[model samples]
Target: MIHIYLCEDNNRQLTRWKSVVEKYLLMNSTESQLYCTANSPDELLEIRKKSTVTGLYFLDIDLQSEKNGIELAQEIRKYDPRGYIVFVTTHSEMAVLTFQYKVEAMDFIVKDEIETLPDRICACIKNAEVKYKTQLDSSSRLLSVKVDKTSLILDQDDIVAITTCEDYHKIMIHTKHGVRQMSGSLKELIAVLNPAFCQCSRSAIVNMKHVVKYSREEALLTMDNKETYSVSIRMLGKIQRALKQL
Candidate 1:
């Protein structure tokens, strides 16, 4: 189920959004709920931390607080990168600010058009449902590995690099969140990974999607997260070909 949150300072507007969202979800039989509502950025952020699943957020661009809507959305991304954000505001002209903030908002709903607010919010929810479902369909993107008696299921996109650890039988899986060590070999892990990963070196296999820049002369690769990894000369041609596919 998807969690829906709303942040609006105006009490009347807040109530209206809550009512419309709830009614729409009930009428359409959507597997979602109006989880929480807040009147300030801080309050909403506090509520956001408790969300266990990807959420749909409706934020007012001009919140009467220290941080406005766009700023709040920026903070939200730090915790929930894949969550959907929709800006519901009276400042229609401020739509361009979402781009400047690089928040990747799902939609911008102008509150001044009161008649259309319900429809717009419902549309955003529908889009979020589709995107979230697509993300959950991880048949080709999931990396499942076993460690001891436990099974670890990881999303391949969250993985940054998989390399052989100092231990002969242990491999380290570097992810956006942190690192994990499992008793295995890079060769075994690579066999299960998708083509988006490239064996850049004998010791390291980097996710090509996260690689930012590659220097053949230097034999180095920089990832989107600013981590650097060595690329073996033999794998340079393979890396180049894989990058082209990206």
Candidate 2:
């Protein structure tokens, strides 16, 4: 069950969006509840209050608040990283900042297309639904890895490598999405990882699927992301065997 949240300061626009979203949900038989409609980000956040309900958010960039939609999404990530954030804004220029901050924004719908705005909104919501359901379908294939205080459900296929971070009890996870810092026993992490994953070095394990090139001379394993990790001398034989299977 997905909970949809909307934050738009303009009364007319907010009403229109609410109508459009409701229509989309009804037309597609999507199992989502319209959770919140707030004129202020504070109201929305206050209502959410530590609830980690998975869902989607349609936010207006110009919120006329201390924090705009993007900033609110950042704050929301602190509590609910699983939710999808789709920005509805008049400004097209701020799109770059979204990726730079690693918000992982699903889509952006410009408010300029007044007539087709509702249709565009529907498309974005549909896209979010497809992506969300795809993730849910692979939920059984995901490993729930804890990064600091945040718990991330990661698809093993997206994982590239896991390496000790030099900090005590910390591991750095390299994924197709990006690097994540987590705390765990290397033994614990390796034990939970898939068969394609194996330790290459005393401090690192590379996913065979992500290993693009393996250098025996340099004892280096290059991942699909181009990040290179050293192979321990003892694990060289195991690494070679794994590389041959790939």
Q: What is the C-alpha lDDT of each candidate?
A: 0.85, 0.81
Tell me the deviation in Å of residue 15 in model 1. Answer: 0.2
Off by over 4 Å in 1: 139-246
Worst 10 residues of 1 by lDDT: 133-142
Which runs of model 2 end up more than 4 angstroms from their true locations? 141-246
Candidate 1, residues 168-212, lDDT tens digits: the string is 999998875567788999888888888789898989999998988
The clash count of every prediction, one per candidate, is: 0, 0
Give candidate 1's error at residue 113 in angstroms. Answer: 0.6
In the range 81-141, model 2's lDDT, one tens digit per residue, is 8888999999989999898888889888898889989988888777766676677556544
RMSD for each of the candidates: 11.0, 14.1
lDDT of 1: 0.85
